[model samples]
Target: MKPEPSSALFAGPFALATLSTPDGPEFPALVTPDGQALDLRDVFGDERLTTLDVLDRWETALPRLRAVAADAGPARTAVTDLRVHAPVAPRQVFQSGANYRQHVIDLHVAHRAPGDERPEGERRAEAAEIMDRRAAEDLPYVFTGLPSAITGPYDDVVLPAWAEKPDWELELAVVIGKAAHRVPVEDAPQYIAGYTIANDLTDRATVFRRDMPQIGTDWLRSKNAPGFTPLGPWIVPSESITDPDDLRVRLELNGETMQDESTADMIFKVARMVSYASQTARLLPGDLVLTGSPAGNGMHWGRLLRDGDVMEGTITGLGVQRTRCVAEGAA
Candidate 1:
């Protein structure tokens, strides 16, 4: 476990990362503000250190790691030399859908028929009314995501040959530190380990089942593609981030800002989403719960990912993640 104190400045703040050393397999590392990587084992003096170990012991581990970060100097290895892995390997991943107010409204407007003479303002007002009703009702839309879809922050987003409209939906992902089931919204934050960024890549063309319209969204076929969820470069402990809702979420496609909104736009913010998810299932340590994507998807822009497109996503304190699109079969 070696701490690199000489790496270049990272795009933003981060606490922990899973990285592969030049000669070793992937391992958990503490990322310092100095942009250096500190092997958790070396810092904690434990050889069996892993990201999960730190998360499960977050009550005691985070503070110690922060103290080390406060004094970390130049990185030991060039930041570019390290290979970043998804900061976590969660046993279960829960995702919220259409959670952002404006995002869903945009989809509503975009999907309206061309011949419809309804005013845009009228449609938006109606959608807003529906969201208000939903908020009052306290129901959050959630779905399951397979860990097999997770990938490193810098990995390529493969556009499958069969997927014609592969699009990006960047989101704020919450990491659970404690087992929670039927927890109230007020008590939800206590179980949060930290936050990371997730680009919830979707296959727009397959969102609805062609053969079974009544069956609705076929998320498995449209979303669970290999390397679809380009996760964290690192995880920022929950305590470090003052307010998850106030953070900014922005994604640039080919250097153009597409999705730019705050988590505050979420109809059911982090706590409610967590609490809602807990109502049905137990959330364990290291579980990844996506808070939902906020507007600005390619579907609204009339464009979709192609083999050479590049996407860069950032969520406030979380660091940036760049993923280039590639044809599934291309080398």
Candidate 2:
């Protein structure tokens, strides 16, 4: 909690979060803008209702959630007093890679192999040209992520011993509201339930199959480790965000700002990414679509994550997410 003001926790009139008391089971909750968390078990009239269940019938649940948020009684508890968890347990995760215009160019130049002594300016110009062509002709580079990689916003991220170059990629996560199959980009918005934040942690050492160069990137090995994706403190309704393309996505490593870019830098916007994903597979309620991370990852700055590092990430209108890095076998 760090004594940060409640206003920094969420935006709009209200947001949805998963929370639990010290010894109680985790449950869905409606969090007011002022930080009061009202458990939705009684409101839903079912103790077994999870956030996924609420999202399954988002159209019907929205009105009820709004009504509760508007007049949450004294039965609510302060959010600071409860243990926060990931907003929802997603069944599927679609992650977009190299989708940021500037981020890709930066990665291209920074990751030059040994003995490649081309000037930085020339390398950057070449990278920019490649990015421009990709935007014009190639579809977004989207990959599937395991839901097991997800962890709470405030949870500890255990950096495995094998991950020698762990890095951070803060992104805007699109939470699906309805089932979508082969949907058009124009109709993608209707399937969106809301938005949240996700930090897609990667291990640079495992990024490529060094033994098999033709295999290229290995996302599953580099990014799907447990606690690799630190998710939301809450999910802000899509209506609350005036423009998903205009939000600011920022991340700080141990109190130092590292990634501070805008969604405008994304090569393929949220709607297009979602629509593209639907073309290949059916998107169900509670599925997460992670828009690519903007520039300024640890590799770009030569400052990979280590034990005891703290990452604080926030997206405009979505809430703040803070996670502490812990060594795998730490006490």
Candidate 3:
């Protein structure tokens, strides 16, 4: 018989919990909805469970724990006062760009046509007009960000003094549960431990300049600014997010909604992305692959982040994360 939906919903969110001690190394802890934190590393030691040895094992463990909780009910201790950390301190962070269809169309229109006899200014104007027309159409686009750009859940984002066009992208990031190479689309879910919220910060001026002939080919530089990728709050185990592709994702600057859309709008589904990524490189345990963001980002509207801006990003079923932006030289 198939498991009940409620059983799935009870699946715990993954996180690394650290005690408020000044000396010891923080260990991996599993979070329970009732607010209980289990020191899995302490309990399991350096054994297989200490780390999610394999994706399938992690998936299997969820239902097993949920069943135990269901049986224990009133006896199950809830972890209410634990401090949450990033689910996984990954060795690498992989990001996607121009994966959204709307973004692709916008880019194409921005550049001059192959053989069209149009002046540079005319092409720029036409591109702007095209972007306005497609405002309502959510297109898929993808790009990558360096792992060094990553910061923890409550970490502050340092807005560099040189960044004249700082912007934020609210995206859902998938955590790899095992090493996978050439994974098939249908079997991709088996490799994902869970999902979390990610803010893909960008320096727009530097990014745009890279497209010009003079500067040329510096995609990594435009994205790897310090504190550019703020991730976490917690990881919502895959089993808990019944339909990841259908969840609502939104971003708010201060208190105003800046980006709001559903993962259903993604041109390339999560499974496909996993499969595609695996074809070129081996996705090891704890690696993060941030799915592309939707429309309404500040960059699309010619707006840029300023000092003291607070950004909150959330994905339905996953936890919300808040970050404050500090100017480059600010102490």
Candidate 4:
């Protein structure tokens, strides 16, 4: 079971959401200023007011939504009264790879390939040097993930039978609000919609193809599995978070703290990641750019996911995600 958060919700600006219900269809709602929620249809007097509707007009809708939230007092529904679903259905997902200092360093020292015969200290130093050079010379490493892999924050993660080692990667996901192609770092923030938390679950056993080493990594087979990415409970506006580079990302597995690190550890920051992503592909509204996962993955802890295990991931103000793991049946 996931424990309740210690902090309050009204301290900042959060966006709308689509809710899950038992009796009727899913509905869109606003996260009011008072931490309560209001039906978007009622607030806007338009039944077609979906979270996507709000996102499509994010720049103009923000002021109006903020006003509604501010004025929404006693009449608002308690957030606890409704079950929250994924805030928005993203059109695309871009994941960063080997972008964390500690994470990559850990991998280098752990995997004793032909060249990894160096001492642990030497390996750490080498990895640090490599990151420094990459930041100065190389562009960010990114790859596409199927949007269909996304699921609700508190949903169950059904582990496929073919996956022998499923790992958890808690990352800060940036949601784009506008289109950008080949954008500069200075102008990247203008394209951002907000921030959300995403758990980029991966099948470690299939990351690299054993049969065909020359073809490189098989990210599609290792990643992109259904319900592999668990997204937010809410999306905090870009303005709400003062510094994207200075947030804490944490994940606890089955009541034990596993991955806990600062966003400060990212090799490439948000602006650079967004800018680099737009260099080739056109980044449209509602697309997700997942900043790479920080240190302390399952590989570092020597334990991968299993049935009935609970993963609770929190990224500063973005929100918490509690995903219960279950094994897939042969049926």
The C-alpha lDDT values of all candidates are 0.86, 0.91, 0.67, 0.83
| Per-residue lDDT value at 180 in model 4 | 86
Count clashing residue pairs per candidate: 9, 0, 21, 1
By TM-score, the candidates rank as 2, 4, 1, 3
Better of 3 and 4 by lDDT: 4
Candidate 2: TM-score?
0.97
Assess candidate 3 and give its lDDT. Answer: 0.67
- The number of clashing residue pairs in model 1 is 9
TM-score on alpha carbons, each prediction: 0.91, 0.97, 0.77, 0.93
Clashing pairs in 2: none
Model 4, residue 81: displacement in angstroms? 2.0
- 10 residues in a row with least lDDT, candidate 4: 1-10
Q: Where is model 2 more than 4 Å wrong at Cα?
A: 1-4, 72-74
For model 1, the stretches where C-alpha displacement exceeds 4 angstroms are: 1-14, 71-78, 112-125
lDDT of 2 by residue, 161-271 (tens): 999999999999999999999999999999999999999999999999989888999999999999999999888999889899989999999899999999999999999
Error of 1 at 94 (Å): 0.6
The best candidate by lDDT is: 2
Candidate 3: where is the Cα deviation over 4 Å? Answer: 1-24, 46-83, 103-144, 209-217
Predicted structure 4, TM vs. truth: 0.93
Candidate 1, residues 1-331: lDDT per residue as tens digits?
1223434333334478898777888788877556667777777788877898888888888678767777646344444568888999989999999899989988778667547789989988888898889999988999999999999888887888999889899999999998999999999999998899999999988888778778988999999999999998778888778899888999999999999999999999899999999999999888999999998999889998999898999888777888899998899
